[model samples]
Target: MYFERAHISDEELLSFYKQLLYPRMVEEKMLLLLRQGKVSKWFSGIGQEAIAVGATLALDKDEWILPLHRNLGVFTGRKMPLQQLFHQWQGSPLGFSKGRERSFHFGSRQHHICGMISHLGPQLSIADGISLAHKLRKENKVSLAFTGEGGTSEGEFHEALNVAAVWGLPVIFLIENNGYGLSTPVEEQYRCEQLVQRAAGYGMRGMRINGNNLLEVYHAVKEAKGHALNEQQPVLIEAMTFRMRGHEEASGTKYVPPALLEEWAKQDPIRHFEGFLQYLHLLDTEKISEIRNTLKYEIEKDINEALSATSPAVSIADELQDIYAPAPSAVPPPVTTPVAEKRFINAISEGLRQALERYPNLIFMGQDIAAYGGAFKITEGFSDTFGKERIRNTPLCESAIVGAGLGLSIMGYKSMVEMQFGDFVTCGFNQIVNNLAKIHYRWGQNADVVIRLPAGAGVGAGPFHSQSNEAWFTHVPGLKVVYPATPADAKGLLLAAFADPNPVLYFEHKALYRSISGPVPEEWYTIEIGKANIIQSGDDISIITYGSGVHWALEYAQQHPEQSSYILDLRTLQPLDYDAIRTAVAATGKVLILHEDTLTGGLGAEISAWIAEHCFTSLDAPVMRCAGLDTPVPFAAELEKNFLAKTRMHQCIQQLLSY
Candidate 1:
């Protein structure tokens, strides 16, 4: 209702002008602040200001927005106090509610504008689920995410859009088609004629508009809102604009060549809009002058005030706050012991299946996870039973599939993410590492994600399909890592993960998925994370193992009955069970740690070090560790077997037994 032809009035045009001028002036002031060392850093949305302000006008205050980097205009359009933004630029806590969140990634959950990210693609996936929540909650708000055309190439983008298109999610995917992506051209980033065109393949509508024309953008976004809310379908809008500046102010455009710069600069939306507004008697020379003068004063005041505001930049303790909302230190929720418990794998499925019953927002998604029962068939019969709404068979873009799951997680959905093969998880590292892991570290947000990777290098999966990458993720903070060795443990560990409030990486070893199936109670139940399960007891030597290594230790104890041995299943790796380990080592006086990862920095090394510290006094000899040789797991069956198997675990224990 703001534009007349677009149903927006002259008053709205002036408002848009005021907003645009305000951000432009802020950029100028901020750049100067940076130069004077008043502001330590800056990223600009210079020429693309009009559409940013325009998109904000189409928003309802209750709606949520997740914007990628270079969305300063959009950030301010939502009325992030200019001074707060300037203070954020100057590294002040006043700009962020959580003292440690990134500057532009500001969040006022009260305002419903979640945050922004420097990483591309994943934010869009999260937007889809947030929008889906609005649809389910019957809220009239839309969830919108904006990104550059360069992001179109990321699998996360494809995954999010495919799900949105299939489910008709009430979301908007906005592409800021600025010609360059860090020196890469749009043509190089994609094969599609227009990025928007790909939406139709996913069963969503697509629209394009003049990125600089505030009126066009406002109207186009307004048109999409009805379908987004009413039909619960997504729409792709490509705002066609050239990057009048480099990717950022500090990004030199020397690669663009001066000729192209002049060409794009001539089409500067501000100058063009000035001509259009003056022609319509909406904005003339005198009004433009007044607006510029007012904006300059406002910009100056915002920078000075923001820079002057006193607040801590960051402190070490803030590192753990928002990862899980830091609930009072209490025991994990008790796993329900159902009266009619079933098999372990099935029990786990039931726990996840029943999770949807507890929280309707919970969704289970993966490739063929529904009727096809997932690639491992772990979710077999879920689609037929839970319906497609809960179970999904996503395309093979692991990046996007996981990214979309992450999207739902951020929106408070209990998303049970499944990757067919453990090794395939490497494909979605961006979503896991950049977006999922950093959501809390970067902005103190609980992404609330649960990713289940069927890991270990056994069963002849070979190099690409059979590698254990747990060590890679153990290095990341703010994520709970678990390796459930048995059926009962799987059911209990998975239930506990769902109940917990942080991002969890559930590594279900493929070798144990069906090979070692056992009875699990029909009753609901959960097992505590960060606690080790004792499989067998002996005092001669203590062997700490997890996943397939647990089985090896058990076999060793059985085969060598004469020598007493104790086995510890380290179910959770991150929050280790040091008490159980120390207790076992004290009783045995010798410790042997084993796992399937490489020898250098595998879980075994850490366990060995722990024993060397706390249980060193009780130890009779130095701790021994056995793991896969530090090399790629080969394809040959016999070599692969010798390569990944802990053939040395039994031998290492024998050596410790001798000690």
Candidate 2:
């Protein structure tokens, strides 16, 4: 069923032969470059180039391709300049990734190809998101995502395929079943007879293709593309092929059996295709020789030109500047006028409502976010007002959702995604920390995404439901962490987060969602991220906190007026308001840091370290911390209170005052 004769015209069939030879020849050249130390690494799909060539040919020019490291043929087939590809391998700034990444780990914004991260399975979900975007726009375009047999075992693979199937998105999951995943054989990776059979569980059509047969692969992908575009159906195609070399050049083939290699070499895709073309009278020795010579000359010239180009002389400042989205030149100061009293949840809903009204490109996605209005009703009536396309209810797949949001942001859309519960964010932590956080720095890409995390401990929500994990985000470099305390700040910071160019992790305290109320402006306002707000003025000691900690610190100060304690609410955690901390420490000569997260290795530790380094002489006493105990949150109300530091803020303040 997988094998087929040439279905294309004579001219097209001849061209197909060239496409198969291109990556194979290029891989050979790259291997030599690797030995010469001109290129860093080589992940060659030398014997399996037909799969990429065929798939790329099947997709339309406007369609997107999410390609993996071994899919070099896809890049070349997309007409990506040989010089640029050589430049990428040679580490020249002229490469697609600006030398931020080595080899095929970068993508082209112009061509709609996503340069994949090392995590093999994540790109499938990202492609699903891109396909979702196309579906939302009512475009006929489809997305083609590539992965290896080993990647099919990853949780993201199932998440991506399941979501795509559930939505009936126009996407094709192309799995290169090359028998081995790195050093492990397919026998060890899965128990299934064929990986394509897994699609039945996802309710998607599945096909197995002879990947080494160019015509078979091309026809399979061509049919899949038609299925996706016409029926909005996702199809999983397992291209059975062989890895002619090690996973990478450094990864030797010592583990591969000699007899198996010899057997597969006889079925080498390039050789078989060339022989088939000869049989069809499409080529002879003279024609093949001429083609090889021309391509070799062109490739070598490209290699030489790329080698002559300059590598980027990136400085620490230059690298750091790329760590975040470009800051806005200037933003108007936030409006402090009170329009009406509102709860924190209402403020957040209103903020999102205003954002959807303001930006046409902004989208909201989360589990139960549309008709259900999210788990917290933060988006109640959003689907009715904004339409289901804009207010999307995603499957319970956090990693894919985050990845999809990142993909949308990459395609010039601003996404506001929710975690449902902050603790559930761990499920999507890979996308947050690895892909979303590093895209800008690695490839000069801006994931203008806002991840709304309903975080914090209170209400006896237990360990899984209640975890103040802001410290986890603050530790990552590319992300901006914002934890607003008041209703006004919640609304303002959320707006600011959406406005900011970089990915922002906006931590909306779950406990403060309905518990806090204050006057919030109806007019659109953006609180500058990374700025601190002084809630109360005092002189004896400064209490620095954020989120729920702000209220606790304020209450502590109100109870002990004689202590003259000041309350500083740090709205943003990553780009912390160090200046405010310095001023407070210099004025009070004593500092008390309070937070809902556990004590050890918390943001408090970083704050205390900075104070000791820069504000050592300003301190009249050692910095004190009142933080949650180093243990998982308990279920009972009294145990939860004892587990939190909110109850001990006043005690910590008194101790700092005495010191």
Candidate 3:
């Protein structure tokens, strides 16, 4: 009756049935492989097949979808090769992620599918970015992102929904409310009677439907897509379904009630749909048996091929090589045109202005960045010049904004996210480290995003606002960290950071923003990311530092003109200039490292260890470190002065010079 009301063609209904059954067959085969210890793990979508198949089928192939671990049907329905899928599950080198990731943890850009991370909620915001790209390009495409009932508890869920609604982006937020979230019941999950009701809070349309009913799911999703595309608004759909199996193959169903299982079994989506097909004369028992048999045979064939596929070889060199995309080799020669003295802040602003003018696909996202010109006025006139779409003013949701930046990068857009303060980056840390830093290494997906951190401790802003947190990202493998000491490097390195294909953390010391001034190039230019600049050359000791510490080293050298110290300003921290560091240490034979971050696990530690290991024979004395104390930045001026490395620079240099 529902099928008749929907007016779907009989052939199309049969095709849908086949699509729905394919995932079920594939899952059943995977379960067998799991029991036999062939496959490592499996997230069963056996009962919830209708929702994934129906919703995916309703969308255009070019429209992106971010699916969860259990949505195996989304992959099958999208026509991703079964052999490749099996290979992916089996950790084969020929798999989508090249065996770097397992299960549905990988995405295929060619298929318009962005896979979810272990943390379920961030993908929703990434979907917002993809939808934003579609809207910006005036394309009639909608992005659908999936989450479970329990995922709504995360702050990212609230932020993502609010952002989409505020922007009126064409996005379909699908929540597969399948009774439980890995053993926690819906009763424990939400206070609302239904998850769809939460959409009203975001000022978006909401819909609830029986997820088990294939026809109902297809019709509802198709209608939701229409509404999103026509109105350019986000729609939240809560598909009611039951997880017939445990969360995964290994996680048993003992926690689920037998009575509830028995009750839901009578409403099995596959059987219910098969009965409907029989009634309509579209399929019969014999036909169903034949289809199942044929599908089983094909699934077995694919599984066999996957089993025969070569496993990834254990090679550390190959893995290290694959971590980052090859750096661009065609860097334009640095301009030697007329120069003008400018403040560091103005230089950064100029570089951003030039980058925006050069790359149309480049966009900026952060709180108060548009009309209000951001927290520090770094983007004072950006919104007015570039327009609001490119220079977006985001909500106070760092996690979602970072994820959205990653999504934009996935869609060929470069994004710059400015954290109001360096300390606030903790809010978006997960997205930066787990999603953006890992995406390219996981799937060869470039995350060309730049996060600007206004860091350091000299203005007496206290613990929350002035801490230098660059070391946190510097430890991350896929991120490039750059800290400039002067106006010229600030402008030139920022341009270089934007030009790099990898994710970059550009640290701008708040203390030096307006205090420092130097001659910057009048024309567009770039300073190499991993190169160091020698401010003043000497022979007694090498004072190696970056950002605010560079200024401290210069001041110390100026005060003690007798101490011949090589003031080496390391602009880029991640891909450090080892050659320059060696040259400095070898020339002076005595070295001192300095930074604003805490000393124990700071960048100084890494640099000292490397120098001790590689340049020990060249050193006349031990490598010394002058860094901030291991405590929260103090509010008072005296305590703050003691907490900073500048207080100890005189003693540290005196000792190193005497040695």
Q: Pick the candidate with the highest TM-score.
A: 3
Whole-model lDDT per candidate: 0.76, 0.87, 0.90
For 290-314, candidate 1 gives per-residue lDDT tens digits of 8898888877776666656678556
| Ordering by TM-score | 3, 2, 1
Q: How far off is residue 472 in model 3, in Å? A: 0.9
Residue 609 lDDT, candidate 2, scale 0-100: 97
Q: Which stretches of model 1 miss by more than 4 angstroms?
A: 1-4, 97-103, 106-108, 135-141, 187-194, 199-203, 227-232, 279-286, 327-343, 517-521, 610-618, 631-637, 644-646
After superposition on all CA atoms, how large is the RMSD of candidate 1?
Answer: 3.3
TM-score, candidate 3, is 0.98
lDDT tens readout by residue for model 2, 334-393? 556548999999999999999999889898889999998888998989899999889988
Q: Which stretch of 10 consecutive residues in model 2 shows the poorest summed lDDT?
A: 329-338
| Steric clash count of candidate 3 | 0
Q: Any runs in candidate 2 off by more than 4 Å, and if so which?
A: 1-7, 329-338
